[model samples]
Target: MELPEVVSRSEWLVARKKFLAEEKEFTRRRDELNANRRRLPMVLVEQDYVFTGPDGPVRLLDVFEGRLQLVVYHFMFAPEWDAGCPNCTWLSDDIGRLDGLHEMQTTYAAVSRAPYEKIAAYKEQRGWTFPWYSSAGTSFNYDFHVTLDESVLPLEYNYRTKAEWEALPSGGLVQGEQPFDLHGMSCFLRTGDAVHHTYSTYGRGTDSLGFSGTVIDLTALGRQEPWELPAGRIPAPDHHADGCH
Candidate 1:
């Protein structure tokens, strides 16, 4: 197996120091980017999207759980699918107690296109405690562009159209794949009775939030997705929503 060159302790320290400098620079740039992201404008959420939860049907505002901010995981579980997307489950497995988020006046939840019964069954099967809801028979998924149906809404994913995606070499999947649900994270802010859409990210944009994905990213092999450079490091799995698309 290939590995990094082994060297003397002193030599390794020098190389580590050089890498540390680069890492620090990257951290600074990332801090600036985070600041810019926080400053991005938010949109007013006018649509009254309702979701079915364990307790029963609830409006979008109710999903916030009276929190000032809401972070939603657009889980990829189509209405017809018996189970959630494997890739989405991969990320969901990393979700632990979110008391920290709650303390910060934020509520985290997962929304899927599957029926509440299916979502509840899967959630229990995986032993997940985080709130999961169903957007079945609602436009919540369609409005968020997570559930793609050209007949209902124009095709758009990760801020790109079908044509835009097809133009890319790795975008062939989008050509034939339609009326499919994709995974994403969307943030919303509640001010009194009004809910504002703060931010939404899809595809690789969600990588950072996935603890498992983030840890895998730090390894030599990376996430083993097709888009990663030095390709064919390993056989990429058939990932539905969260993987490269």
Candidate 2:
């Protein structure tokens, strides 16, 4: 790895202090943005979307497990695919357990279009303790804007329509094989047996939720994705890997 320029302890301290001030400002702004996010209006989920889990069929509210808030990661595992997306799996690796989230009155789970049997087997193989469900034979994925119909030209993703995606190629970031599912995250709130969709983010918006990426961001490498890093500070060619689809 290329090291940064060597500097005296005094010079390092000066730079660190300056950076700390900027960090504090960033933190404050982030907190304010979070407050605004919480204040966004929510839409009532009236559709009776049912998902299949290891325990059998379960409604959207049932996934909450009696919790007032629910966080669902829309895993990209199409019904015919043998496995889930590698990128989604990479994010899942950072999800250790649910005990902490549960204590905060939140329930978390991964939902996919794959069958329940496939989801169960994959979850066990990965040693995941959190609940995962199959939304196959339902419009849950489409309703949430995670999965798109192949017949619809120009895929809708990350809140962008197909035309917008095509305008900015970004090395085929939005282009890929047809009839495939995408990944996303959705948040919900339950009130007196009524469920409401509080928020949902797709594509890069969901990147910050993973612990592994946060750890990498703390380092000089900073994810090492092509889009990140300074022009001359890019990593060696061999270090690059095909990221999310």
What's each prediction's TM-score? Answer: 0.90, 0.89
Write down the worst ten-residue block by lDDT for model 1.
Answer: 235-244
lDDT of candidates 1 onward, in order: 0.84, 0.82
For model 2, which pairs clash?
A: none
List model 1 lDDT by residue over 1-245, tens digit each: 34567799999999889989989999999999999999999999999898899999999999999999999999988888899888888888999999999999999999998999999999999999999999888888888888888899888877778787667655543434567888899999999989999999987778777798878877867766645656335524422335523
Best by TM-score: 1
Candidate 2 lDDT over residue span 39-155, tens digit each: 999999999899998878899989999999999999999888888899899999899868888999999999999998988888889988889999999888887878877474445
> Model 2 Cα displacement at 57 (Å)?
0.5
Off by over 4 Å in 1: 173-177, 231-241
Q: Could you give the C-alpha RMSD of every candidate to the true structure, in order shown?
A: 3.6, 3.8
